[model samples]
Target: MPAITHEAEPAKLRLAVIGSGNMARRFLKQLPDSRRCVLRAIGDRDPGQARVLADEVGHLCEGDLICGTEDEVLTSDEVDAVYIATVHTTHAQLAMRAIAAGKHVLCEKPLTVNHVEAMAVVDAAQHAGVRLVEAIMFRFHPQMAAVRELVRSGAVGEVRHIDAGFAFYVPSDPKAATIVTPDLIIPDAGGLEGRLFDPHLAGGGILDVGCYPVSMVRAVAGAAAGVDFLEPVSLTADGSLSGDGVDEWAIAQLTFGNGVTASVRTGVRMVDNNTVQIVGSRGTIELLDPWALSPSPRVVVRRVGHEPEERAFPAPGAYALQMDAFAESVDGPEPEQVSNADSLGNAATLDRWRAAIGVRYPFERDDAVIPTVSALPLRVPAAAPGGDRAGTGRIEGLDKPLSRIVMGCDHQPDLLTASALFDHYVSLGGNVFETAHFYLDGQAERQLGRWIAARGIRDDVVVIGKGGHAPDCTPEAVSRQLVESLERQGTDHLDIYLLHRDNEDIPAGEFVDVLNQHADAGLVRVFGGSNWSVRRVAEADAWARANGKRGFSMLSNYFGLAEPDDLPWPGCLDVCDAESMRWLTERQLPLFAWSARSRNFFERADPADLSDEVLVRCFYGPENFERKRRAEKLARDHGVSPSAIAMAYVLHQPFPTFALYGPKRLDESRAAFRAVEIDLSPEQVAWLRGDQS
Candidate 1:
């Protein structure tokens, strides 16, 4: 549909902001539909938030807008394009959804989870014939182009290495920063992590905000495309993983095919700002907020035989320009920037890093059989005084309905522990299991399958497995993945089946239909999401509600017990956010959480053996470390481990929390179970929450 431009010619750009949060809001307000563009709508799961954003944007905008769901906005007669600032994990999915919806898409940086998904997105868009661009908004900053031009012009010489810094000490200004679309852990284009700090999501420092430097590399070295076949002849990477699997800061050296080597590093858990330093054989360039080169974000070049010179350009907002480019592409060919190659390079680089660092993500496997959740003999209420009675102490609305701290007992090559870890959490009364058809290359699910078959305890445990990625999330795929999960778990059905991601391209309703079919087939009981938002959820729920079928009854969000630097899952907390919270609080849909520990502070808890970033922030930060200390003190006072206190904090919330625990040692499982029994007082919970009052 044509946009209602305020111009006398009645020209305007019809635009929608996907994942109406901080970046989306900023992207809209700044553009305010001059004669060139218009805000057509805002899409989000939380209609309240979407409405609020639309109202705010309307006040600032010159176009008509309606608050709606992703489907509404993407498929809207008014929406011609979208600027997505939704959480990171969904970056790839939603990007494709918007693109497939026949609208152009401008997504936040670090598109997709891994290279595989990244490539899939490129293919999907190509087949669908839509324009898609990674919203590395800063790239459009004229200053950014100036910096890149300076480097490309050989003013700084042949770029050999780069040192980029993107960090900030974000004081908790609920408004200073909009809540991350996905908690900090949402996966990046690297397929490394689900959060910025998650080594897996962030793909370490360089992979996190490192995209800026790499994008700059694309500019300076003129080497963004034709990179799939390019491998740094000799690359050595040494980095740190936070308690979970996030990378806080990382250093990697890669020698391109031409002998040009680059080094990249980034750490944001401590400081906040985006700066890039480039060193060529003949000179160097330095840029602050290199990614957002606007209104003065500058670049300086130093030559071998000359004084440092400053180069600047008047930059158009990257998001706006990208959107304009996307709009133009509809009438032309693909864009030179953020093209298919851009997505592929970003994704492939992340996968290579994973291969290089030996980082493992949940996406490694393709399918698994999901086990059916049976009615528990235990009368578990939603919540209790000390917390959920499942023993994690998280105050769910129900008691033994299920337990948090679901341990990954399947044998991982890196794991030195036995599959008997399940028995350990069970000994502590844990009644939840997390497995997938593709987990442990399928062995873990098999182990679970065997256990369920042998024990006949299906009624006592809740089984969760997710599907969709690098492949279709069709009913057949869902069935096959569930069968694999069942085969691995040795079960005929799953207690709960989660869509690892919403195949946004397939209409959210269609995705839910597959799960609903399985439920009908008795292959799974309840349906839920591993990385979905309320918008998608509502789309699914509305479809189900309208059809008189069961909708999502549970939400497995990326919830945990530490400060999240990025949105955990793309649009993860949809059901946990203020609006979703109220809905779930009353509707009784269980809230299951992964990464409950955020990779740190477990008592008998083994240190979080995650990628890297999480460990740094959760265990090293003043606030987190202090909490760990308090947990230690609490443990000393209560005769438990500090880690137990951390788990206890999660258990104290008003939701059913399920944590995925992967302990290399059997003793670690023993320690994680103790968390079920550590009854924390409200005071202790508050202290852990940093609420001294």
Candidate 2:
């Protein structure tokens, strides 16, 4: 699809402002009229703020301003593009909304708090053919280009090191100049107290001020490397936290791929020279006030043999230059000055620094609360052949039915790949798509969300979101992950959810209670355990019975026809032992068997020819080899693939079992469908196992 241009085709571009905060106000003040950008709408969650900006915009443009909800502004026909100066956490979400509405977007930086969300927003923008630029104001500053040019011209003599820092001291008192006092500035509701120090809003020194230094270093390193940007090879950081746990001061040491090293520092509670210094073997260039928010800057160059030279740069408001650049891109085919790579690279670098410094926002931590659910269209089941047949088994306590065969989405590369697989599975009677929060760094859910939303089949399929894998199996971890999973999946509730892995340190009862709490709120319909021992399942069930809460209704364990000689990975549980199998058989609880074909052990002629070392270690035992041989022989007798026989063995078990399969191609998907066609009898299953009884 081509980029969605404004319908009016007027010389002036239609613009809507989505925030009325301090930054937004500064942007409006610095914006030049020659840019031919018409401010058509102003929207904020607080209508009063929106009206204030609207009145100001109306006075300037001499047109009635559209002061309404965000939806009104985004959907307004007069608006061609949106400038988002909202809080950090809302950046990605609002950008996505603007893109989906077929409007261009200039989002306030750091694009998003995390790289994952940033990537998703960028992908969405590209898919929609709309220009989405991060609000890295410094990128558009004329002096920045001058610095880049000088460095590229060898004035810096093969830059090797860069040192940059931005700091300011803002008093803690609410009456401070930086804080609030309607008499001093605009009426500030929360002041800095409401935003700058709040971790939930992703407020921190690194995100607010540290980004400029990181961007500066990346830019200079890119010039030295003759690339747009240089990826960091390693990063180390340390920071001081505010009383509220947000980073007040932070510094990071970064080593780039070009062997260049850089040190960047930022803070909100200290005073330092706000400058960028680039040091090379022969000379050095320093730019004072690199952020250039408030004053003109002095550029000084010192060389090994010559007297130091200082140049004066005409002070230019970075925000004005940024808006002009955005307007040009909106009006023409030219790309934004700050490319997606720059934004994504900067965001990823900041994410690393935050991680190294142990500065995590509420959203990244384990205690983040679930966002309020907005009403969305329920997913409707697709009326397709075998679509209903796929969901054959009925699990107890789940309102929605699930397909007997589960589809794994751990390796889906893109939306097209996922769409193809989703279409194929649904066409052949599959509905349950299994994903974990950690899978693809939460991309699986995002991809599934896009697919389902585009197809309008949310109700037609069952979504099973798994979270709380090992190392984060506490009750709080589970709750927090569940909330993020639901948000990522773009659903209010899940049909069936499970823990991706277990932690034995935490009591099983604790897990049950947290899961049940979500169930009570309709966030989860039916919950279960994955890779959990049978003993742990019993413990949870016993507690659930006593507390009147739902227990693990299903078990997802590593079960298939082949036996494991060793564990596939550290801390992985294989519940195919005789005792575990007996326990499931006697209880008749539904079993979601992962790696149902022993990672395709029987699918290969040479079991030892496997490439997956984990599979080889887990299924290379003599008994398993003998069983694969018997399965192959049975496949020859039954005129089916050995892999199909293995699948059939799991499906034909005495217990209620569903095999989870990951098919990368259509042919493999078809084969999977055919595997279920060959139902094996109890006698046949035993015979394939070489148990003549």
Candidate 3:
């Protein structure tokens, strides 16, 4: 037992409530105000309410009392963090304001009503250099995490849908006269429905109450994305408005990036209770009042892997635990809190659906655009001794930030050769594959088909294919190429599809529509543009927006070292330069480099002998001679091959681009994968760019 050493006292959190609402009251009453936490002050509109709250537990928060305004509370001499439990409309503004005031804010649920406004709030909070949280206390429950664990653990094979509802009528203390009644005088008589119906204030049956499903969607979606909770590709929602024209009830269907979707039904004026059922490929997880309590009501798992099971953890005040965690975070350097932006994005999904359904709020100026809020995020990541540095390594738990190695496949005729290359690449952590119908005059697809079928590695590879290699990027070509590519690779569908070349004359929308149609049919999961110019990329993206089609996710092109005489290929060189690379980085588009090693452009038939191209280049071409000589020296310094230096040069680009390796041998593959782990410093890149430094 190691002599039963005494443990040190845990760190305590300091908290200040910015509102004296019922929820705030509940939080204050339940949570302890001792070492783990202490109330600095309470702010509310009514002095009576604040004083009552301050006096409710005199013994607990002995030194603290109530304040009049948010400013008074935030600027107080004694405080560590603040929690906002005020009106929904005030949520975004107040949270940003608090963050700006240099205080950590845990605003009550529903970060905001719209995506843009929500993003603004996040940006603002970031700018303020303080913590901001959208309080969805239910998410803190272990049962929800338990559900995620079950889904991820493969207990529910691949989850395709989540169906949930949180509904209960708020009659309020034996259901007397409404809040509008003059007898008692309750301000903001609009209540939840006021902001819930206001498109400006972020209202709707969904916005009013759709967070349950939208939040669940975030929990399930594969990417760091704010998925459209209604569209199947992303979301296309419809709502049922109440007598006030706000979303009293709503129905939404959201599709995940991976083709998984959820059917959501949520409302506030419901006649009954709430329930959630997560339907996966294996089975379903059903819970009654899942958002209700810890030990969290009861979780019933009907999974395919095992017989149906029911589990209940000994959850005692899970919400308190969440508050404690947030408080502790504020008390420390970095808080374990998800930002208000995440929560706001989710609520905006509901708001969008409500807007589409004509649910309007008081301040909402336009039904199309959700009301915008000013936002600025302020948290600066921990600095190194020398401050910020480029090509920096990993930031822990980056919310699905970036993939390291870009996977490439050679469209070679010999299926075994490419397959062997792919298998070796996989062994080395490469999964992003690139292929084309016209590769090797279409024989490469057949080879990949046989190879993938033999390896049964379809799930492991993110297969990318091209269809417009032929004259017309027609619907027929799209269909034929997709089917043929699938057949060749022995896959049901490619992970991504690219327009091999842009038919400048063809309306980009038509191509997007064709891709969308195929995508709808599940032939191509993600369709992108290859050899597309910035203008064409913009055009295609616009078309996708106009036609409600999926936009491009990747850009593939021939972009690497040139021998001065190095010529440009159609559409291939559009994004080849440093400026274009910077643009791609800003767009967050994943760039897939073709001919990364530039072997075919310059390398000799034999490693020992420099071919005529290499010989002619080194002796006659001024730029080529300098490039070779510089590469030789750098390779010597790094103890890597000159060819490895070339590969690293391409890999060195900032925006998460991967090299399309066309290695002719296993040794080449060995060298290429080895390059993924080697990150060149800015100095190294500059030296290579100078080529003769």
Runs in model 3 with CA error above 4 Å? 1-7, 33-35, 170-201, 221-232, 294-296, 304-307, 331-341, 344-348, 360-693
TM-score winner between candidates 2 and 3: 2
Which 10-residue window in model 1 sums to the lowest lDDT?
369-378
Per-prediction TM-score, please?
0.48, 0.59, 0.52
The C-alpha lDDT values of all candidates are 0.60, 0.79, 0.62
lDDT of 1 at 344: 66
Task: Show where candidate 2 strays beyond 4 Å.
Answer: 1-10, 178-190, 293-296, 331-336, 369-693
What tens digits encode model 3's per-residue C-alpha lDDT throughout 1-693?
Answer: 568778998755456787776678777765762346667688776756777777775556746465567667777657667888776777766776677667777777766645544555565565566766667777766776676677667676777777766644434343332433112233333354344445555544465456766776666554212222222356666656656576656677777666677777776555334677877777887876566563447788886658888887656565576676676665454332344535655755665566566765544431122212422221223334654222232212121222234445554324424544555455455556677887777676766665555555556456668877647566667777788777766677777788888787788887888788888887877777877877788788887888676787777776655433443343444466666777787886776777666654334423355545643442335555456566667777877776677777777776766667666554566566556556678777766667335
RMSD for all candidates, in order, please. 25.4, 12.8, 19.1
Per-residue alpha-carbon lDDT of model 2 for 1-693, expressed as tens digits? 899886764477788889898778877877653355777888888878899876665665537778888888899998999999888888877887888799999888778877656765776677578888888888787788888888888896888899998766556776755532112232443376557789989888888878889988998898888776787889999889977788888888999988899999988776767788999989999986577544566789999999999976775577767777787877566453588878888988998898897777765543233221111222244544743454367788855567777899887765645665666577667888988898888888888887777677787778888988878878898899989988987889888889888898889999999999999999988999988999999999999999998889899988888877776766677778889989999988889998787777887636547567776767777778788888888788778778878887888888998888887654456556667778677888887776783
Q: Sort all candidates by lDDT, best to worst.
A: 2, 3, 1
Model 1 residue 537 lDDT score: 76
Query: By lDDT, is 2 or 3 better?
Result: 2
